[model samples]
Target: MSAGQSSGRYEAVIVGAGFGGIGAAIQLKRMGYENFVVLDREDDLGGTWHVNHYPGLAVDVPTTTYSYFFEPNPNWSRLFSTGTEIKQYAAHVADKYDVRRHMRFNTSVEGAQWDEDAKLWRVALAGGETITTRYLITATGFLSQPHTPDIPGIGDFAGRIIHTADWDDDYDPTGRRIAVIGTGATAVQLIPELAKTAAELTVYQRTPIWVVPKIDFRISERVKRLFRRVPLTQRLVRLITDALYEFFVYVGLHHRQLVYRRLNIAASDLAKIHRFLSVRDPELRRKLTPDYDFGCKRPTFSNDYYRVFTKPHVHLQTSGIEHIEADAIVANDGTRTPIDTLVLATGFDLWEANFPAIEVIGRNGRNLGKWWRDTRFQAYQGMTIPEFPNYLSLASPFAFLGLNFFNTMEYQMRHMDRLFGELKRRGATTFEVTEEANKRYRDRMSELGARSVWAVGNCAGSRSYYFDPTGEATLLRPMSTRAALKEASRFPLTDYQFS
Candidate 1:
């Protein structure tokens, strides 16, 4: 990686060292590809876990379900592991599996060019380093980029402004008025934690989410010992959780009404729980209740969330913020509340994670942005983009069930691994998905999207980030898990021409 001179050869180059990237690195290293690098912008492992250190940050899914299946952890202290615990888990996986040494920390892949004749990927790094590899694998996760909401008076604010992705530990919230904007997953967990410290807390809402209780409990020391002793037990537990959560996709594929009913019941149960858990304010309850179906956006889970509204210092603002004035949030209803600090819990810039700003020129000087834009950034089974040979998205479009992202990540990785194996067997490097296959794949997705909850989720005329503007569903796979496997297996990859 010295200057502009590319070593002009590598078996593969991976971008991002998150779970997917680490997983790919493990597979490739085991496959005996030594001349490779796992590039990450951050100077560390644990992609999302390395970045988001907000208060009370933890996985909503059970610990067993959240972890990687290839190497399961037997000694989790809690059922729902905290952010710190999860990050440590990622570190352990990297160290134990011996994948950490292959990583290029504090480095980012600016763009990639496909060398048609040489069948190598010319990848340019953030600085002046350029690495050439026969194959390129991208694991930059879909949710890794934080999209801070554009608020007025942001620069004018004298007090410290914080984003959930970039948490400021130096600015203490203790005995201060804190305003949290965006009631997404990040806000849900953070609000309760903030309440414990802030003298007064105000939660701004554009749309309230339908959240179920996040059931959590500590795993006994004896259980950990047992898991360590009998490693098979941990795998058995993971299999069970994977199956249980996988059913959320199953229902979406087959029995839609029942799943919808269950989602509704869970939402209704929240109100009853709030009766005993939250503040006894009628307007607050009304504001929190979502008119949309449960699965519209990502559903949040937490036992303490509803109870947070009951805190004496907490206030729920449903009128939506009109604008941000200096040291205050102005609501649309003309209500102004003075606050010292503002926290943006708004979700990440998921759609534009892959070089939304940079221009990528492929072979024939085909602009990657123009190609994706013309084709709507749709992929074949949400894996490979046409014209971008040796390029694959760790992106899960229709495949994103919002229940278990890791499950889809594993599936997508398996497909990628197979593709690489084929490349090695044939001694072919340059590759691009056929336009016919991509069109069929996108068409199939549209039909599946038509019947899924993403299409049916009644959102009071509001739209979730899950759906694209065209009204065609962009998230949540249409078929069952079994069907997805079948489709994945159909990728004999002969449709891809190896130049």
Candidate 2:
């Protein structure tokens, strides 16, 4: 170990160096928090953006709006940013703000215990190091954990199996027969990209998803140069584009007529695409048809996924995989698809299920896992847990998910900065959101969510991560940015008696 590595404790400890973690660190630092440490298991930051580097893994959100409002990128080379580009942008932002000095890379946290006696948190790392802090911030996002399907005989399969989150850097899939399981956003983006290199590709599907065209293109050097030369152009573009997408989210999240029409327009456009695109029989087209209302499942955009099925080299397996036998996958229809590679685009763990693995003991010896379990894994504002005192979550329970993740993270971090400053000023050892304050916020938000397209929409047979296993649609926030701001504005810190 280097001499004087500084085992000194900080005022706060943040887990995961994703968008939320880095943004929170910056906010805290801006608020004059020099003692806090941002700990990440990965050698680098970027959260999901860092790990999932599979082929064609990119942000579907437009480049203009999919970043921090505080730190806009004028040099986005394309309409939709690729995973690598996003990572580069994140690294740039971190460097520009001098936030890397506060980060501890490759230091996985085992668990944290809230030291009630000292009014501090004792952080346990994978190594023998332990650090204590008065506060904890969890920015480990919704997509941090990969969900691998627990198929029997999966381990026995001779072929290489890779989760989208854990793509092998050295492994190449060129000219190999590959089987891709699941058809979410990840699947749609990856399948098309893999088609170029793979000799043959078979996409397994249990349920079909709704995908529209992604109007993506590379911005010319002249445009980017112009943007850099005139900063207002980027600002103006960002403002206009941000407002445009926010409307789509607004209707989808809130109960506005515009969202309904947009949903209809979405369905009509997709249904029309399938009508001309599917050269296969009517049964195949119908099987490919989605049962749920548009926007029920996370909406995807792909210009090539449907077109890839038209490829003679690529085949779409409409039937579900029954089991893995020897070196092949046997489907429910008694057909076997042989492949040398298996890729799971099976999405993430948004159920807040990873809480138990990391012990976060809060007030009165209460663990976060137990509290979440006892309370049905719900968060008050999708931020603070009752017994956790000064600790806050990034994704929380139900904050809206978006590519503009850093924007939300910075916003929440700033809010937290205000609260922490208040705590310091009052010289209070225990400062928590009153239980009444928490419940009231949730109740009102639930009412607002019910009116939106997310809850009471015409969804039928679509199964998605957006809906929990029970089919209750409560994951993403149903409120728009304007609505969220209003809701956030309602919950002033002074409403809760901090002591």
Candidate 3:
């Protein structure tokens, strides 16, 4: 159906078709509410999976822990499933839960504003259409917008330029000389693949990333059958994986100064060891080794990422790209290398173009992005804002829990159920979090954040995306996943104003 032709009110409107939006829709259905719509600008349902199909794309987190806690996929091809499998899983879940019927593909939302008189939200779409709904939920994932770096003479480059997020399917790099910029997680997965084919591969690195060995293996049919026959077995595996992930992220990363600073040191040493075994050259290994502490920026898992650098044809250029000539990139120290193709592995724009991902105006002309920037980026429990009544931002600051996004989605689903249950019980049309409650939660998070590695560790040169413009590491919440779930379910009802 054409989205622009449909203009009407809904009980609720969900502004994403990703896993978060699917989970929220499931929660709403479980609450016996069906009058809603899921909207995505893309033509497909899976958000990142649909947008990103670059070579060697797979989940960094283990597949056992990355799935929804309530719904487990018994037949995973690998321990770390490919992007295609994740997208299939998303479609399966949406179909099984019957939420696909309520989704509108190829729909772009421009902005949303609160209607004070009607106590509803007026959502503006790209094609001059308005959708009014009692509740507005923005599940636009954190990494929604692709960020193209503003390097000098980028537009004048005569070589073919490709961003990993928007990979060209027909383009072949078998015999071409290629240059890749930005060595983030995506590059870790892709560089090895490019090295196998490219005649000459150059990687321009600004900061070295900590890459650990991935213990990924194909799942046997016997194990798959066992998981299918006994769902409890899968649940137990998920529990164990979740525990290990939580421990590494919570204790190893966040509590580096307190108990077991050796854990972080050991992890760093392991990465160094991994690099030493792969790249025998002392200078190359030194250039690959990170100077900052581990977990300042998120670490990736890959066995081949380091080994790829050892190849004769592959060159690691530490002198950053100065500018792009028509067919080559010049280094800052006046070294220029010609290339036929340029690949940008630069990641998403999290703060500026993302966060809200669109313009959002609340009661009394309060803009969400402007407010967050002028003051500080804070969300009450990472879901609700003080002035945004009946609004839920799924990817807000302090919302992402653990390394696995499924953990975040699970707790947020619970939060949604509990919050909406109160609204139904009170017969309220609108609900907004109290300013006092928001402040208290923000203060508590700030206190916890002080002990994190990003705060106390050496991160000046890290250039981590975790740090916002205020120089605060406000992306991941400082608390453990268990605490986040507990708080989500048991937060005081008085924290919100129901009317």
Candidate 4:
């Protein structure tokens, strides 16, 4: 019953104590199932929030709709909560649901193999410990692992080098010359914060991102009191926010020209803000504009990202990076710029097969990595795979909903709850997705993705992580949130084979 005590076998073992793992534990406990353990590598929960401690990290989605549907928090300080507040919310949920007692922190899964004779999963952990379980749920999210590009002579950098994901708490950048590479989501939030302190800040942008204005403000105490008094008011607000975000799905994934025209007009307004209000220089304004259509890649929301460029000490460089030296960066045009500190914001490895970051051996010694590489990534409803019995992947291919990830996690958890309930009803010990069913789902996904903007848009040069190397958009579901919720709620169990 204690943490990390491996004397007896478990009914289920959920990996990575993020929102997904905690949500799964809470759901299982609520269903009167308690023989499970949640394992996390870190000493605490909040997978991404526990790791990323950057200067100005915040969620882009509104806090009103970013929480679990069952348990809503009426005490959000801002419209978009900061990273620290989000992590605190995760902790609060874990404690409130009594899920923290079942968590084994500082325990990492090295590999997982299916034992054919025992019909159980043999999960190897760090420190040479092993645990056996009837079911394995992987909650290791897509954004947990940080991806750093291989630049020439990167190791030869003489100053402090940091990636946005692995920021150092002791290192201070005040009055220091800082160079930031890759202007992605993390960079857009942290750059403005860094610009306030750094003596001279230089940003190396590979491609322009479409950043709209962020309408963030504090929720007053009176509003919070009203939300606490009448919970339905908050619920209605969340519903409206969710509906507005789903409208973006229609504009981005489906080529709705009318909605696109309206979005273009909004984008034109943003362009005026950029050219007239933010930057006065002509060349700088041109470099800031994106050539591709909106939603080709992930759209960012920020109010000060463009305004930071107008500062006298800040510089934006769009030239290709050639290499790195001891204390400077070399551009493709042979221009050398000196820097005291380096920061790499080069996003995560979302599309690769090496994501689970561990060896997973399925039936017939089939490696999950090799199988994905050979046949491409395919999953049945983004939860179960073809050959991996008694295994479920949270937020896998076609599982991510762009509106908000918390909704996606809740949907997957609900689907898994049904699967487990069905298994209990049928008295089955194992389950695997049928190959035919997985293929049909994958074909449908490909067909829908082909018409999505990420597949056919002019975002090839944007270095977006939306698509894989084979030009397939494997990240997002090309359906509305309501449609995805309905499907997850009542999918047929005939697609799975149980024993």
> Scored by CA lDDT, what does every candidate get?
0.75, 0.76, 0.91, 0.84
User: For model 3, what is the error of residue 46's alpha carbon versus the real structure, in angstroms, after optimal superposition?
Assistant: 0.7
Q: Using lDDT as the measure, name the better of candidate 1 and candidate 3.
A: 3
Top model number, lDDT: 3
Over 349-412, each residue of candidate 3 has an lDDT whose tens digit, in order, gives 9998987899999999999999999899999999999899999999998888757899899889
**Inter-residue clash pairs, candidate 3:** none
Off by over 4 Å in 3: 1-7
**Clash count (model 1, backbone only):** 5
Please identify which of the two predictions, 3 or 4, would achieve the higher TM-score against the true structure. 3
Which regions of candidate 1 are displaced past 4 Å? Answer: 1-8, 252-255, 258-279, 352-359, 399-401, 460-462
Q: Residue 283: error of model 1 in Å?
A: 1.6
Model 3, residue 484: what's the lDDT?
Answer: 84
What TM-score goes with each of the models?
0.92, 0.93, 0.98, 0.96
Point to the candidate with the largest TM-score. 3
Model 1: which ten-residue window has the lowest total lDDT? 1-10
| C-alpha lDDT of residue 160 in model 3 | 96
